[model samples]
Target: MSLRKQLNDILPTLLPNNPAEAIKGTELIRLARINLTGNYSDASLRYHFSIMSCDPTSAIAKVEKGQGYYRRSEPLPALSGAQELLAWTQGRLDDISGDDSSVDSAMLRIRKFRAVVTRYYEVNGRFPFAFRDPFTNTSPLGNLWKYPELVLVDWETGGSPDEEMSLDGGMLSLKQRLGIAPFRLHSARLRLSPSLMTYREDFFQTLSVSMWAQGGELIYAGPIADEALADGLRKLSAAYGVGVTSFGMTPEVLDDLPRPANILNAHPKETEAIMAKLDIHKIAAAQSRPHLDWVALNSLRSESEEADKLVAWLNHCIDERRAEPFKDE
Candidate 1:
């Protein structure tokens, strides 16, 4: 008799019930393991099988199988694509200072990693178990893949009205196409004028600064009061009862500081007076201090009244930890 026929007949005796279905399932798994192209060793196959079986007890077994696969595939050459990707990611993590350029590059690298993995999946029809941290041998996909790209665009000078509108629409469409939920970080710029100072209070009160600090980009307009900005943020955190180590402006704080207060400057004398009151050196120092949490915002500003209302509602939702419509006046 053929091997399949013999297995179908004999598996019934070995397994208790529904031997026919079990046999078919096993055959399908076997086919999947052998037919798929990208790097499925025997150990990987066994791991895949355990996962497919859906037995709770098989978790440990799968880990053991994974470990075996790693052992067998050890000593990946220094120049391999996987090794290079890991090295780049590690380097970024190690040397990432509070510089905007550095942060931007790191984010780009993350996106590149995602693109690589996604391409592999598309071509191979499965995720490679071997694609993991070289040191921990653990997959970062679970922790990082789901996190949306936190892009910070300056609202002013980012684009023309038509271009900005197109980009806003594009972002929404991209999220839908990728099956990712809408961005958690609202893309609203926080203006620092006296009139908007009240909004800052509402911001601190309405959103979980801790949660936002954990992820997302914070873009801001140029000419910010770096030191005052940091102090204000720190005070807000304290007022809200959130324990934060530090809060400060980005490296661009110096470049973006309100043009130095001078008679020749174009800014109005009153505006320059306000700018002169800001201690640039002190702000820079506060921002440069170690152990301080850096807060950034995207530079993109929403001009629409509707967008402003959405941001307000989003703030409310963030505070409540639910996305329900805003009911409170």
Candidate 2:
């Protein structure tokens, strides 16, 4: 059986009837981990979201706070593919931080570890690994199927012991370096429930500050080139009670600020020069010609719209979790 099939089969059994909330929670962990590496290409991170989906549930979930760190009980079926993803992400992180030695060491260690266990499983029909007392190997597949287990599991099955190491001098560090505060990036998904509606304003406020601090701009929902979308953004801003202020961006400022396009669009070179010339003040001042063309984009972005949708999807997962039935303690 393929790994994806195995994952789908096993994961469902771990939850209480509803599988959607579990899936959402899993993706959240995956996203935060991958993004920490800073290896996502223009659209690499987007692929993670594209592959995500969930079902609705009417059961309400009992909230648990900081329930110890989650650890997968079984090895991922697409272990090889996952390794490649890690490599790609780590490579980008290495490049950004100017640390080749650490990257090389980490990759080599992972390769050696994988090779040792995979060989054992193929030759002996079971993993040759063992864990500390009171712990035993299990499949991450969650007993949803009767397939024979091939991999050993403990705390390590889910990720490396140093999964948090990726944060050192990486994306998370960047945020800390900027002293950027965290806030809720509100989503339409949360608006679906009265319980979550309270977070709406707080969410947007958080996102706005985070984006600005990260050298990102607030690009609300809009069409790539639709005038209607632009007008819609103006209305949405007022309706949502979000604020927009004018600013300046000389070529230097534009070059330094991280544009959402650079992270989402497949082709950014064409817009790089133009985007750098966009001065916020000029656009707000109703400047004509070249300046206006660039200014229009700064006020809104296609990527922001995409990010907002992803946030909404995540919010839905939260709602789904809250609605799930729980067992008595």
- Among all windows of 10 consecutive residues in model 1, the one with the lowest summed lDDT is 68-77
Best by lDDT: 1
For model 1, residues 44-118, the per-residue Cα lDDT tens digits are 545454442322222111111111111011111111112222222223233334565744443333333323322
Cα lDDT of all candidates, in order? 0.29, 0.26
Q: Give Cα distance to truth, residue 225, candidate 1, Å.
A: 16
Q: Model 1 compared with the native: what TM-score?
A: 0.18
Estimate the TM-score of every prediction.
0.18, 0.15
How far residue 53's Cα lies from its native spot in candidate 2, in Å, is 27
**Highest-TM-score candidate:** 1
For model 2, what is the error of residue 208's alpha carbon versus the real structure, in angstroms, after optimal superposition?
7.7
